[model samples]
Target: MIIMKAKIILILGIILSTALSSCVSIMTRTETDVHTISERDTIFSYEQKNAPGNQDMGIVYPSSRTFKSERRLYQRDSIVERKYPDFIRLGVFESVGLIGTVSGESSYGTGMFGIFPDFINLKSDYSGDSGKLFSGGIYRIGVGEWRLRWFRDAANWTIGTSMIEFLIPSAKKQNTLSSIFPLYIRKRYYLREEIPYIALVPSLGIGWYPSQYVNLSGSIDIGSLGGLNLRAYAGFAAGLNSQEAYQVRMSNESDKSHTSVFPYFGLGISFLDFVNIVPETYKEWKDHEHSSWNIGLIQASLIAAGADSSAVAQNSETKLFTGFIFKIANASVALPILNNQLYLGTSLANFVVLGFGEWGIGILPFRVGYWQTIIADELSTEPFIEYNYYPSNFLHIGNRVNLRISDFLNLGLVMGFASGETSMGIGSDITSQYGAPISFSRAYFGISVGVSDRIFFPDELRYNR
Candidate 1:
């Protein structure tokens, strides 16, 4: 009974707390962040240009350096009129023993590309009664706040910010305040059963993105009047935690979900600008040597939290957090090992977007880093009695995308959730439970900058050159 009260209060707290927290313009934008596929599992880095597992150069002609390529070609082939097939390629049958993907979109290797600005939904629509909107009447999520959004050509300044804002419905039903007191007692309070309410958020943060592969930023937010929110980001950034699609034991799963925000630091490289390996004597319309097959890289990023835990448990019967936290609950309330320490993850944006782009819709895909858990804590106590946390491991999957609107800025969106159950049954010891997996997805928005000097490998570069 004690445990039930604690958990119930905790869940309700999340519902309430988010009301204020979600009010700050937030950024689901992690164009500069990384994630763990499992619980700190499959650690890796971001490979923006080349897909997963590819070699690194500086910049390929076909991929970028438009003006530079054009200049180079003009200077080299003095007899411009003699050139027939300007930007053309020959086949494997004509080359010397084809070994690697030495060709188009790497039929041999993985074609990779990362979302320009960490794809997210930057637009939203909400219409309904303000009272109802305030109490889960009608509303929408997925709007971010950006400060100093320096685009691909926002001068040579190093500053920017991105914020996300949403609704935190207050309780609407009045049954919550119903109470019957003893005849001897005579007292009545506000009869307060806070309704789920909506919030207007405007986050402000500063960003330092000297290069496309890096962005260091921080911000502070306020809501519910007293600046109820605070946030910051630096180095490699990613969500605080991956989301899970809520799946009822005997019902369908919820595809749209709210993902936790996690700030992190990064230290890695972007193969976006690969060094060109142009042939000695190239044939424009007939030479295939100048082709861009892949842009790959090996990178690493770090994530950490300082005293990132939950508010004191409503009554303390249940634990709140292990490492990081939200207003209501903590993710993995058992990470006693890491305190303000760093977690690692690899970014396969390059491979994901690029790989999917070839198929058409530019669908990006990524594996879980720490999304999988050996065991997720299970609830044992019931509203009737008992108290315990059962733990187990589970699996998760997710993806992200980049939607470019103009040259100066762009938007981004990402979604992911967990699958399978790593439950901790109420029975004696921790047990393994098997069932259909539960998954969650998040859609946010962001603005990308500095794409002027960039080019569309091979095709675009070839013609310009």
Candidate 2:
């Protein structure tokens, strides 16, 4: 009986030991689980605290840490607030081919031709000059603006400053050698989101220098897909100054009154407007993976004009013009069109040199074209000069093919037609008694080299996983 009681005591001891060990194990596991839950909660709370401000600021974060099920939720919560750009800066240079009419005139008649004529010579009834209308090319620049917009997709309204200078053929005989400064307001509207190549821009301003005038103008931009565009410009101006502004002379000395009115139209290449539909940073779409942007640091071209039978015979020789485009700040876009990848960009530069004698300094702001890669970063060719116009009326329409030597260097062969009226001896004169100054076109072949690089954006950066 005593041995049986001892056995019972041993069984009771075993049961108690087992129950105590289980309680210790359960306590340890509970502490560990609480610690893990606390860490997770801390991380989540921190993210929540920063997420609101980041969304408001349009700060995009990587989604690698997010689970698939939470993606939709995260995206909805992180929607960025849309805001308009703070300021929009504009720089454009234009060459105006104009015709003018003088109201109530004398021996020179009531017409004017060629940019800004020698009003004094015309009034004095100079001999060997029977032209009634003065027609010529004028230079203009638009710089600086205060811009307003409600959102990224909204239209832009701007108030800006502009300057216009009339090119007097005979500076010695002309009094209108000064520039007119104007304060203007403009409106620009985008026609479509998918196609940013078309737009309508209109402006109005009052200017004073050689004369006081109120001006109204508008332009339609077309086919700017690759940095080069065709611009149709029209404008009218009414002079506000007195008759003495133009020094008009009549049959009698007492009839010293003049009315100046100018209405003009021009068709030329312009690089004033460029909008990118496919930003380089947008890589979310599989098709956009190859899209890129670049800037050309230096560019050179060889141009030939007057290749046609009529132009060559009239000019007496085929003319060749060589130029270098330097200090370029441009915008480039890559697109897939016609089963090929095409790259286009604006060729805006600060200076240009044409041939040895003729060069333009200060804000040479227009050129656009496209090239196709023939051998993936090794060779590329552009078959046409969509539209390339530099300062003082150097227009180039041609084809170019390039061979890449390194990441930042390229050599190219160019051939095409060019047109310009220059007295610098680069080409023969094609001027006429009745037409505007220095108008000529010819065919050419040229070689070029440039330094360029692809532009990178913030979204291209990667986060460590």
Best by lDDT: 2
Compose the digit string of candidate 1's lDDT tens values, residues 134-243: 12110111111222223553321222112211111112111001111101110111112121112221222221221011212232211111101111212221121112
Off by over 4 Å in 1: 1-275, 278-396, 405-410, 418-465
Q: Count of backbone clashes for each model?
A: 82, 20
Candidate 2's residue-wise lDDT over 1-465, tens digit each? 434654694475345334423332321212111112111121231122234333433677554344222222221223333222222333344444443422233212212212223323433334223444434334554434455444573556766664454432221123222245566677766575444346677878666665566668787756444333465667776653344544322212324433345565555443332233323213222222223334444455544322223221234444443443343434455544543334455554433333333333323334445655576646667654434332245565566677777645567776766555433222111122112233545455667665442332213212100
**How many pairs of residues in model 1 come into backbone collision?**
82
Provide the overall lDDT of each model, using Cα atoms, as 2-decimal numbers.
0.19, 0.43
Cα TM-score per model:
0.16, 0.40
Candidate 2 vs. truth: CA RMSD?
28.8
* Ten-residue stretch with the least lDDT total in model 1: 88-97
| lDDT comparing candidate 1 with the true structure | 0.19
Off by over 4 Å in 2: 1-91, 99-134, 142-146, 149-155, 162-181, 189-200, 208-212, 239-260, 272-298, 301-336, 342-465
